[model samples]
Structures are given as C-alpha cells and as structure tokens.
Target: MLKELDPLLHSQLRLGVMSLLMGAESAEFTFLKEKTNATAGNLSVQLDKLSEAGYITIEKTFRGKKPLTRCRITRKGIKAFEEYVQALKGYIK
Candidate 1:
C-alpha cells in the first residue's frame, strides 16, 4: 500500500512557502508573496492554514508602526515535506 500524503504539504502555496522556508532562517511576508506570486489575501489564508497545522511558525510584530509578518518552517514541516517527496517518488517509479 502507498503511504498517505500530507494534505497541507500538497497545497501549491503551502508547499512553496515550506520549500522556501526550508532554506532560510525566516522570510518576510513580501518576500514570500513575491516568490510564490500569490495575492496578499490568498497568501494570508494559506499561511493561516500552515500555522494551524503546526507546520510553520508565524511571528507578528511591529516594524516601527507597521505590522510585520515573518514565517519559519518547523521540524515537523521538514519531515512532512521529505515524506511527501518520498511518497511521490514511489509513484514515479
């Protein structure tokens, strides 16, 4: 039997975000938006999903007076992404 895939990691935006975060310490909201080519609203929604899944950590703070959002992938996210890739490889073979 095939292994079950993580639904959260399968999402395009969420996957992109995790892939990027996997490489960096953390990323700003604008950087993620540009990299993913996602709309602000869409990205925000997807981010909430990732956060709720405990796959990523979101830090909200004030940069002077404006709000700043930063994202970092959790250990669980890395493991999930790796497993997702392995599951996909099984299908390709």
Candidate 2:
C-alpha cells in the first residue's frame, strides 16, 4: 500500500518552499515568491500554515525602512520533508 502524503507539504507552493529551504540557511519572502512564482498574498498565507505547524520559522523584521520577512525550515520540517520523499518513493515503485 502507498503511504499517505503530508497534506501540508503536499501543496505545490509549500513543497517548493520546503524544497528551496532545504538548500539554504534561510530565504527571504521575495526570493521564495520569485522562485515559486506565487503571489505575495498566497505565499504569505502558505507561510503562515507552515509556521503554524511548527515545520518552519518565520521572522519578520525591518530592513532599513522596509519590512523584511525571512523563512527557515526547522528540524521538524527536515524530517517531514524526508519522510515525504520516502513516501513518494513508495508510490513511484
């Protein structure tokens, strides 16, 4: 039987976010938006869901005069992503 996929990370945008976060220390909101080709409002909402799940951390601060938002995957997120990959493998084979 195929393993169940994580509903949260299963989202294309969220999955893209996690996939990108795995490669770097942290990512700025604009960078994720650009990479995922997501709208600002949509990305913000998805980020909130991940944050609520404790899978990622969101830091909001000011960079000079502008608001700066950065996201970093947590240990929980790494484990979740890894498991998600493993589960996907089960289906592929």
Q: Judging by lDDT against the true structure, name the best candidate.
A: 2
How do the residues 1-93 of candidate 2 rate in per-residue lDDT, one tens digit apiece?
Answer: 899999999989999999999999999999999999999999999999999999999999999999999999999999999999999999889
The sequence of per-residue lDDT tens digits that candidate 1 reaches over residues 38-82 is 999999999999999888999999999999999998988888889
Question: Per-residue error at 48 for model 1, in Å?
Answer: 0.6
Superposed by TM-score, candidate 2 places the C-alpha of residue 46 at a distance from the truth, in angstroms, of 0.2
Off by over 4 Å in 2: none
What does each candidate score in C-alpha RMSD? 1.0, 0.5
Q: Write down the TM-score of every candidate.
A: 0.93, 0.98
> Model-by-model lDDT, in order?
0.92, 0.97
| Cα lDDT over the full model 2 | 0.97
